[model samples]
Target: MTEPLVVEFEVDAPRGHAFDTWTARCGLWWPKSHTVSGDPAAITFQPRPGGRIFERAADGTEHDWGEVLDWEPPGRLRYLWHLFFDRSEATEVEITFTEQGGRTLVRIEQTGWDRLGEAGPPRRDKTRQAWTAIGEQFRRACQ
Candidate 1:
């Protein structure tokens, strides 16, 4: 099994607000280049177990990015990530929010790269870089 990719950062917001920004306002912060359509009109997260994380294009087409496995507001969220658009090749992602002083510490960990078969390592590396960029965007959004 390949090691999980973990990214951690601090945001200048309370835990609840940070969590809301991450889940409910993702479209405002998520990079358009990261979307499957490359031109998504909006990104939406259904904040419950078995709910969806998806992107909607200008034409109103929705693309599935993953399914929620767990949801705990202001604290944690876990989901199956299928950003490659293939559920069979999906991995698991867990994000946690912790309040410290006057800031929120956010941590994201993605695992199950072995499911990607021969492409696992390279894809994982690419995703790590992408997540770094994404994390910065999230942090800025929370500020």
Candidate 2:
């Protein structure tokens, strides 16, 4: 297995603001290229343990991407993620939000690529790139 994919960046907003942007306002910042449907009408996290993380299309079609494992507003969120994969190949992702001089530092740690067998490393690399770009997108939205 490869090391967990880690990505960190700062948001101009405070911790709670940043966290809210990431969760409540996700449909506004999330890029279509990063979504399972590419153009989901809405993407949402159900906000509690065992809750669903999913996408809904304009046609009302829904597809689940993950499940919430832990939820701590303005502090941390841990979930099982399987965006374009089967649930059997789900990975774990934990994101933390920390306040820094009025700003928020967001960190994402994702692991469990080993389940994908030969496709693991490359998928992990792709997600790393996606997260890096998303960090910037997320920051702008938080402001």
Candidate 3:
């Protein structure tokens, strides 16, 4: 089995507020172009346990992209990512928001990847880069 890919960042925002912003309104900060549909406007996340992280296309198509495994407001969220290209391959992701003074310390830990084989490393690296970029974008958006 492949090891997990972890990524973290500290944002200049309150932990509670940051957590709300990330889960309650992911589309606002998530890069829509990064989605499978390649449409940013379609991205959506429901910030509740058993909720969905999905996309709604112009054609009125709602494509489920992930499932919320755990939802604790202003603290942490764990989800299952079942991407389209490989429906059999699933992964778990957890994002935590910790308060430090006034800033929010965000940490994203992802694991449960064993299906990609030699492609796993590259995929993990890609996820790391993508999450890093997304975190940066979120910071900029909140600025």
Candidate 4:
């Protein structure tokens, strides 16, 4: 197994609050520029196992993004990330929140990318960078 892309950050909120911000209210903070279709208004997540993480187009057409794999509130969330362009492949993303001294530490690890072959490295790095930016946005939203 290869090394997974890992990104970490600290938010000024408690673990439960941070988790809620990231999972329950992610659409409010996630950068709209990060979406593949270039529409952030259409993106949403339900934050539960088997819940749909998807996007909608102007025509009301919905695109399947992925599904929640695990839903441990206030601490951990694991989900399948499928951008849909590669239907055969699915990436696993795990986000964990830890409370320390009244602050929440957010750590994201993304793996199962070997299927991307030579593109895995760049993809991993890009995802990490995106997550870092998104995390910062989440932190600000929580503040």
Candidate 5:
């Protein structure tokens, strides 16, 4: 099993606000390049355990992104991340928001890459880059 890939950063927003934006307003900040449909018309996270996280295309087609595993407002969220659109090959992701002074510290950790078998490492590398870019967009939105 490979070590989980962790990404951490701070957003210039209150912890509660940052958490709300990340879960409730994901579509506003999620980049097109990171979407399954490439050009999603809408994206949503159901914000509770067992809720759906999905994206809808202009054609009204909805693609499954993941299922919420754990939901704790303003603190943590855990979910299965199926970026390939296949739950059978899904990985786990956990995001936490911590208040520091007046800003929010956001941390994301993704694991279970070994489930991808031999394709894990390369996929992890690519996803690391994608997450880095996506984080930048999230930072902008939080501002």
Candidate 6:
């Protein structure tokens, strides 16, 4: 097994605002390049454990991305991220929000690639790239 991928973003917003940018306002900054549809009507999180993180098509089709495992607002979120994979192939993603001098530090830690066997490393690499780009967009949006 390999180490979990960790990526961090420093945003110029309060903890609550930063967290909300990732959760409530994600649709505002989520890029088409990172979406399943390439052009989704919306990206949504259900705001609680067991709630779905998904995308909706213009025609109202819901594409499942993951299930929220932990949903502590302004501080933490953990979820099972399947994205294009089956639920059996899902990986875990944990995110934390910490405040420093009024700025919020958002950390994303993705694990469980071992379950994917050979496909694990490449997928991790790709997700890491995606998150890196997304983090920049998120950071700008938080501004």
User: With candidate 1 superimposed using the best TM-score fit, by how many Å does residue 37's alpha carbon deviate from the native?
Assistant: 2.1
Error of 6 at 143 (Å): 0.9
C-alpha RMSD in Å of predicted model 3 compared with the true structure: 1.8
lDDT of each: 0.92, 0.92, 0.80, 0.81, 0.91, 0.93
Looking at model 3, residue 102 earns an lDDT score of 92
Cα TM-score per model? 0.96, 0.96, 0.88, 0.88, 0.95, 0.96
lDDT per residue, candidate 3, 17-78, as tens digits? 88877866677787867776666455667867888888877777787888898998788889
| Model 6 poorest 10 in a row by lDDT | 30-39
Q: List the residue pairs that clash in candidate 4.
A: none
Q: What is the lDDT of residue 27 in candidate 3?
A: 72
Note the clash tally of each candidate: 0, 0, 1, 0, 0, 0
The candidate, 5 or 6, that scores higher on TM-score is 6
| Candidate 4 lDDT for residue 59 | 67
Candidate 6 segments exceeding 4 Å error = none
Measured by TM-score, how close is model 5 to the native structure?
0.95
Comparing 4 and 6 by TM-score, which wins?
Answer: 6
Looking at model 3, the pairs that clash are 32-40
RMSD values for the candidates in order, in angstroms, are: 0.9, 1.0, 1.8, 1.8, 1.0, 0.9
- Candidate 4 error regions (>4 Å): none
Give the lowest summed-lDDT range of ten residues in model 1.
Answer: 82-91
lDDT of 6 at 106: 94
Candidate 4 lDDT tens digits, 1-143: 55998888898989999987776676788776765666645676776799888877666777777788899998999988987455567789898999989998888999987988887778788778778878778889988
**Tens digits of per-residue lDDT for model 1, 43-86:** 98898999999999999999999999999998999999998558
Q: How far in Å is the alpha carbon of 73 misplaced in model 1?
A: 0.3
lDDT of 2 by residue, 38-68 (tens): 8999889999999999999888899999999
